[model samples]
Target chain A: MTRDDLDVDPDELYGRLKAYEGRTAASGGTGRDPVNEPMIRHWCEAMGDTNPAYPAVAPPTMLQAWTMGGLAGHPGGSARSEAYDELLALLDDVGCTSVVATDCEQEYPRPLRPGDRVTFDAVIESVSPRKTTRLGTGYFVTTRMNVRAGDGELVGTHRFRILKYAPARPKNAPKPEPAPKPGLTADPARRPRPVINRDNAGFWEGVARHQLLIQRCLDCATPRFPWLPGCGACGSLRWEAFEASGTGTVFSYVVMHHPPFPAFDPPYAVALIELAEGVRMVSGITGVPYDKVRIGMPVELEFLRVDEELELPVFRGAEA
Target chain B: MTARTGDELPPLRIPITRTLIVAGALASRDYQDVHHDAEAAREKGSPDIFMNILTTNGLVGRYITDHFGPRARLRKVAIRLGAPNYPGDEMVLTGQITSVAEGTAEVAVIGKNGIGHHVTGTVTVQLPSDAPGTTDASRTDAPGAIDAPRTDAPRTATTPDTPR
Candidate 1:
């Protein structure tokens, strides 16, 4: 809507963004709380993680958690340098207003423990020249934050990226592409294998035997699916395996229609099935149209063995 | 291993499943219903629950580190999303080293899924400076080292709607 007013010079804008690189984006920011239990608990609960090492230690994946400004940033904590704002305004002026995060790379040199005071400073790492994406054309801006503890030990480095782009002209609700005809889009010759290794080999071994197994914690009896070596709930390496009943309720489901992978047909339904044993695992839903798959739908497991090498557990709608 | 500027890093195939999609989102503390709820996503104009950009970003980082090994650390990774990776789609990641100087290598990377390219960007990594007994042959034969380090030109996409 706003591009009509300006005769934009693409190179000048690119030059402006490049100039903002390596500037101080923010500094002297402190986490509102010490790396503590409440936030850790919230993260684990939402993640369905039962790893035993949490609370005492944060998940390495939470490297950027402490630096988040949240929905309403704190009064003084929203202090970004003027150059950062000007660069964003320059992008905004050129109609690259819609922003979406692209990627992040975090390196943790030390594990953050509870009560470790979190303080961080960030620098405008780098800004890219004009790049186009399916979402729209935009510039990629990156920021690198070095997080340290109150004790002054380096905790981690978080490099975050975002693409500020103009929204693409809406395709105006195009018709869902029809599944390819058999001769047009032939099925893949073979199903791909899961990344199987020492850590989760036992789970696949159980699948090979046609037994749906849940890893049960020896200390807490908590049943977890997609097996883990140690229990997250109580932090115990001691665990036993139990056979699942293969009956489940569709906790939630989606009908996939795009970016058609060779191994799958479009418009197929995938469901998060809550097993009768009280754990959830994801699998394809069968015996019904993708649209008809509903939340709370009862389904039973059916292991579809594709070709000689691959066998996967899918769910079929169960009779009333 | 000595790398030329155009030397293609081996591609990494990642299966896009409901679980992988959801797990990657949750791991990043992204609780947007659009990521986990299909009905919610449909209301917001998506055909299905799509993988979030954060997950796509994390995967891009994983691909870079996996190729260069532990000695190399990512100094920066910039990416843009293209096609939405839905359940049952597989993403194939490919990259080529564009420049190398002073133990720093710039790589151009893209991840293509069943439909089209899911992401494209550049990753700059700090390779181990102490590469023992480095020779002129070990220096990448590709263009764009620090001396002539210019930003990558915009890439043209094969698909009309694919991200470049």
Candidate 2:
């Protein structure tokens, strides 16, 4: 439909958007554990980084995980607010349906650590109506979230682009082809297994037994993976282990054109997979076409036996 | 200590003030009271308004553009934030040349707020290394040709009331 065909009131839209901001402000905080340390370690390891500063001082992109506290606890405070949900409801009240996150840009003033309580206040930054798409026509709302500490220090800011669609298209798109099943055959010869470094030896050991284990900080109870010396939260040297479901969604992915190491295959799909436990792991995707990979697609972990002594953990599309 | 080739860039020092901080906050649509309101910030434990990372990035980009000129294109930027850049804090942006290609230069950039290297990252930019040439004058009109008045053609209307 043309812009003229839609008779939406600008004042009504502003009121609804204002109410959304009010609700989000009242949410107080998500209170969730930000950033999983072991996951960060695993990612760093996969990238072949030896920088001491990452685990010691976490990065801003990794800080998004720390906002999970509101989702973990009871339905009070931030959990009750459901800022995005309320915004979506308001959009519905204004005669719109179907919303999807399109893009996001975030900035950090300080690296987030464990024990630091964070509260997020988001506002509907702007909204612009767009022409029809494959999914039909609607408005694109850009919401900006400002994260702060318990004492009100600015931690970071995130800008999320959400597309509010008109109610003509299907809610769920058709599923893609399933990934090939893991091969059960074992290679007879034994190859020298890659040595796990001081940081990630525990994780490799857990993988040997077909168990997906995550690292947890003993001090603040924050769970992480790709093990490291000290906890990301309290900076304590002590940590423990917790198992994870070998399932996740592809947060992001890239195909390698160059092999950094002898063991890694060229043109392999490397993806940032968000686990069922709310942690994200950087792993390779196997048994699927590289072009078919999409963010938020369901994937399951598969252990590929490279040799008798080594089994590499990879992922494949989940079967229906 | 001497700076190494691949070492982090030396930090640049910029005075933190409401003007810079507010310009940055508004540019990024980050209207958080802590970033602009001094009294509210004081109530929240912050000494003064702090600059958002986006603004820092923009300023860094501007600095690079100023040094390189307008034709230079920014390819990529990856920055990591470190400390709070409070008002009156010395903001420093440091960088080092990481790699140089035929037409591109990659530099690792970092920003410091005095306490330490508050932010660290990298940027790649494309520059015009060669000078412009005047080889093809026939294909297009030469510069100042169209606007130049004809010497022998006509001189008219020195005064509005007099006819040529």
| Clash count list over all predictions | 6, 19
Q: Which stretches of candidate 1 lie over 4 Å from their true place?
A: A1-7, A45-50, A75-77, A170-320, B1-49, B53-83, B86-164
Fnat of candidate 1: 0.12
TM-scores, all models, native as reference:
0.45, 0.33
Global local distance difference test of model 2 = 0.56
Q: Write the per-residue lDDT of candidate 1 for residues B28-80, one digit (tens) a residue.
A: 55666667887665444456677877567656665665555545556666666
Model 1's CAPRI class is incorrect
- Predicted candidate 2 versus true structure: per-residue lDDT over B83-140, tens digit per residue: 5566544555656667766556677665554344445566665544431111332433
User: Largest TM-score belongs to which candidate?
Assistant: 1
- List model 1 lDDT by residue over A1-320, tens digit each: 11222237878878888999999987877875678787777656444344455668775556666765654564575656677888889988887766666666666677788888888888999998787654567888999888999777888887878878765543344534432222235555465779998768888888899988789999998888788888978989898888889999999988775444556756588899999999999899888878688899999988988778889888998634
